[model samples]
Target: MRKTPARTRSTSRSRAAVVAVAIAAIGGTTLVGSPASAAPSGDTTQFKGVNWADPRDNYADDPVVLSGLSTSDTYAQTYAKASRVISAFRANLGANTVRLPINPYTVNGPYWKSYRGVIDAATAHGFKVIVSYWEGTGARKDGFIDDPATYWPMWNTVVKAYKGNSRVYFEPMNEPHGYTDTEWADLAVKWLGTYPSVPRNRVFVSGAGYNDHVTSVCADPRLKGTYLSLHHYGFWKEYATYDQWVSDLKERIGNCASRTVADEFGAPMTTGLDYNKATPDNNSINFIQADTDTFRQLKMGSVYWPGLRTDDTYSLQKLIGNAARPWLATTNQSGADRLAWSWGRGKPVSP
Candidate 1:
C-alpha cells in the first residue's frame, strides 16, 4: 500500500496509509510438507531487501515501466540497465533482495518479454526477487483483483515462468482489503491448490486488510509453510510514543514474528528527519525508531518502501547518472542507518 497525493493506493485503516501460502500433495504426487506438522519458521533476516517501484506507484492501466527502464527496450537492454541499478542498490545499501510490482497489463502484454530482464538480472546477481501484483488506477483501484479473467491468466504466466527459479518468490496480491478475512483465506487456499509445485516457503501470503495485520493469516492452518508480508507506515497515525508504536506493531503480529516479514515500512526519507535520535514529539521519527527497534528485537525481515521511486519523498534512494545506465544514492544517511539497524547491522541507538 502507498499513500501519496500523486497516487491512490490501499490503506490499512480509515485514517490512511500505506502499505503467504502452503503446500500439499494430490494426484499421486507426494507433497514435501503437511499442515499438521508445522514447518519451521524461516529466517526472515535473510531477506535484506527494498521495493523498486514504477514511477506511477505501479497502478497503471497500461504497462508499468520501472524508473530506469522504458517500455520500448528489448530484454537485453532491460537486463543491462537493471544490472547497474541492482548493483547500485547493493553498493549503496547492502541490499540482497528486491520487491517488484507486476499487474495484468504488464504481464499479459508485450512488455513482459522485456520485463523479464529485471527479474533475471536480480537473480543473476544472487538477489532474491519478490514479485507482487498491483491493481489498476481509477475505479479499478478498489483493493481487489480488477478482473479474474485477466488475473488468473496473469498468475498462470508468472507462475509457469518463475516457479522453477529458486531466487524468485511470488506474492498473490498486494493488499486484499476488498475481501473479508474468510474470503481472503479461501482465495489464498485456492492459489495454493492451483500451484502446488511452488514450495510454500517461496509464497508470501499477504495480511488481511491493507496488509496491516498478519495474525489472521498466520493462524490459518492451511497456510502453515508460507511467509507473511506486512506493510506499516508512519502516516497511519498522527503521533505515538516509541513504546506505544512498539506495542501497536506487536499487537498486529501476535506471536508470529518468525513467519512475518515487514516487506514495506518507511517514513519520509527526503524530509531530513533524524531517525537515529529519540524524538518523542515527532511522529515520523518515533514511528521509524520504534518500528526499527521492534524489528531488530524480533529478528524480523524488513524491506524499505521505494528503495528507488521517482519523486517520492519516502524513497530512500535517488536515481543518478543517465537513464540508460542509472545508479542510486542514499537520500538520508540517518534513515539508511535505521534500515541497517532493522536488518541487524549498523550502530545501535539507545532507547
Candidate 2:
C-alpha cells in the first residue's frame, strides 16, 4: 500500500522526524516526543515483539494509511493518512510490540475503513496488539474453503472496534498461499475455534511461504497452540549467511514445531545516509548484521523496515538512527518500537 499527503506525509514526515530526532541524537538517550504512547496497562507478558516489516507493511507516509488513493474522493485523504500513521505509531511505542496485517481483501470493508485509525493507535500503544485476521474468503464469507469463517464475523467487528479489551493478538493469515498441509490444518482448526476463549496464548500462527520451509502450518495436532509465529526473509541478500538465516530458522522451527517467534525479516532501504557521522556504509548492513544476529539467536521479537522514510539501507533503526547522530531519533520514531531491546545483545536487566 502507498499513501500520500503532499507525497507520503510531507515527504515522509520530513524524513521521519529526521529519523526521530536521530534516535535521541545518537543514543545519548533521553529523547522523547509524544502525542501518544500509553496503552499497555499490563500483561500478555507484555507481548514480547516482532514485525520489523514484511506484511508488517506500509511505510512511506506511515501506517494507518489509505494509500495511493483510489478516490471515493480520496476518502478524506485516506482518513487523514490513517490518523497520521496511527498518531506516529502510537507515539514512538513507549513500551513495545506492534504487528498489524489483516486485509488480504478482508471482506472488502474498505480495507478495514482506512485501517481503523491505525487500529485505534495500536490498542493505544500498549501493544500486545497483533490483530492479524489473515485475509478474507471464508468460502465467500463463511462456508469455508481454506480459511475464513468470515473471521468470526470480522472479529465481531474488529474485536469491538479495537476495544478488544486484553491487548489483542491474532496472526491468522500471512505467508499463507493457496493452502495445503491439510488446508493449513483446516484454516487453523476453523479459526482456532473462532476464539474459544482467546487464550491459547491469545492466538498466534505463522508459516506458509518464508515460514521457514513449512514446518507443517503452525504444527497441527488439531491446532494445539502457544506461539510459533514465524517467517524468514532468508538474510535479505548477501547470498545468505546470518548463520544461514539462523541455521535455517533453528532447523525450521526447532525440529518441526513449538517455541518459534522470528516473526519477520529486513525490508532493505538504508543505502548510504548515516548523515556523515560515518561507518554504517550501507547496502543492507549485511542484512543489518544478519538482523542483529537473528535477534541474538532468537531471544526473538524484532521489527524493521523503512518505518516511514527510506531510500535504501537495511533499516534496523537506520543504523541506530544514523548512530544517533547530532541529536535526534526520528529516522522514523515513535521509539522505533524501543530499539527492539537491541535484540538481547548483552543487555540483561529486562526487555
* lDDT by residue for model 2 (1-351), tens: 111111221111111223333222323222121111222121223344433232223321122232222224233444444344434444443325666655434324665665554445455545555666433332222212222334456666765554346666666655444343444445555555555545555566666443444477545555544455665442333365435544655665655333455554543333333221212333333334544455554455544433433223333332122211211124522123234433452322211
TM-scores of all candidate predictions against the true structure: 0.91, 0.29
Following a full C-alpha superposition, what root-mean-square deviation does model 2 have from the true structure?
A: 20.2
The list of candidate 2 runs beyond 4 A from truth reads: 1-63, 66-154, 158-191, 195-220, 224-228, 231-241, 255-263, 273-351
Each model's C-alpha lDDT? 0.84, 0.42
Q: Which stretches of candidate 1 lie over 4 Å from their true place?
A: 5-42
Clashing residue pairs in candidate 1, if any?
A: 1-19, 20-204, 20-205, 20-206
Candidate 1 accuracy as TM-score: 0.91
